[model samples]
Target: MHKTKISVDNIVDNQTFIPNYPIKMSIRDVDFFYGSQQALYNIHLDIIENQVTALIGPSGCGKSTFLRTLNRMNDTIPGTSLTGTIQLEGVDIYNDFSDTSMLRTKIGMVFQKSNPFPKSIFENVAYGLKVNGIKDKAIIAEAVEETLQKAYLWDEVKDKLDKSAFLLSGGQQQRLCIARALAIQPEVILMDEPASALDPISTSKIEDLIAELKKNYTIIIVTHNMQQAARVSDTTAFFYEGVIIETGDTKKIFTKPIKQKTEDYITGRFG
Candidate 1:
């Protein structure tokens, strides 16, 4: 796996590389279950502010499950329960926060497959803003344009704002979804394999957008692409069997992992 150098300076010691940023989200002793089956156990992770943290693991390893927990998306599923604290900016998401819609506004999500509503391109981006009760047409229009620009898609679709979102290509559709997520001005973005369904060019575009977006948003991504993880993330967490085996600077984790499983998985010895 190729390792990208991190922009932040870290004080490296024999044991760990200490990141400089404050923790945006803190997960301590987190456990998740679905219908009596435990999917995660004793999970602890610190997501740094304005950084990209990648979660990589094999299939059914609970990385996506853990992602959904951040925004309480799992609460929609029956027989699902989560124990332990997940705090965003020092506020316990489960205990202290009662407004799910508000919490989700601060933390937005993009899925593996691009899901665009059967609406016009402009409406798709403006949906969240409208739902949030922004009634001023000029304000909503500017926000939509700004969000599309942030998603690196304004120039492509500017002439066709009234067009159906389904008329766009697969890559354009995915970026439209991203623009939709960004419309709410979320502080953190959760992406579950955002580029997995796209071609190489589109995937590269997504990676580049991620690097730029981290300047303003804390990003957490669950991806099976090890190289993509190494390339885009400042920190990397290797999850095995629903547990994080090791997590640290992306460079260290890819070059010299502390765990045998991490090393083996990164080296493609096994999943």
Candidate 2:
């Protein structure tokens, strides 16, 4: 990982987050269920435009479940349901946008493991463009290259656009997946432990990419790595047993948390 000092001056952090910053998305009184089991409690959160907000907690704390709710990924699961409202820039995702495909285009997701199509690297990124109805070959080609560059993978994979995505290393495959998500020009990127499966160097590159991407896209990341959250997120929300324990500046959450559970979890006392 890139060695960088963590101090107030080194961060653009939550304290400096203007109260007037536009809200990119909102989650209000959200409750989630998987069959008979309740997952998320009355969850309320705001995702700011051009900022990285990280969700952190121990295993099965519903951080990942809540991240999926933003883009309605849970809809695929049988007997799953969500209550209350989730809005993207004041538009109710459930009511205003019945076109789930468009919603997904606006908010793309990267999973825990890198998932590439059984095709060439170029085709992997081009797949999203094709799905979005871009038929022009020039446009698709330009987008594939541009997205790969934005993902910081163009240099490594540029010579092998025709090569199979499966042939790439795990880290490269993850970046390819990120490039695939970027090809759609999504406004928000939801990452669930995106760097967890990678080596340290690759993980650092992904973190650096996250920092750059947040200048154009709102990023919500779910991470079990507290250090990664501290480095990449402007604000951090700590979740426990499906409820938010505390949400605040990354500095405060790590250095001086308001809640005991938040402190304990961050200090390695308990989950």
Off by over 4 Å in 1: 1-19
Candidate 2: regions farther than 4 A off: 1-18
TM-score of each: 0.94, 0.93
TM accuracy, model 1: 0.94
**Candidate 1 at residue 205, lDDT?**
94
Candidate lDDT (C-alpha), each: 0.90, 0.88
Candidate 2 residue lDDT tens string, 105-158: 999999999999999999999998898889999999998889999999999999
Highest lDDT: give the candidate number.
Answer: 1
Cα RMSD to the true fold for all candidates = 5.9, 7.1
Q: Could you give candidate 1's per-residue lDDT for residues 101-162 as a string of tens digits?
A: 99999999999999999999999999999999999999999999999999999999999999
RMSD of 2: 7.1
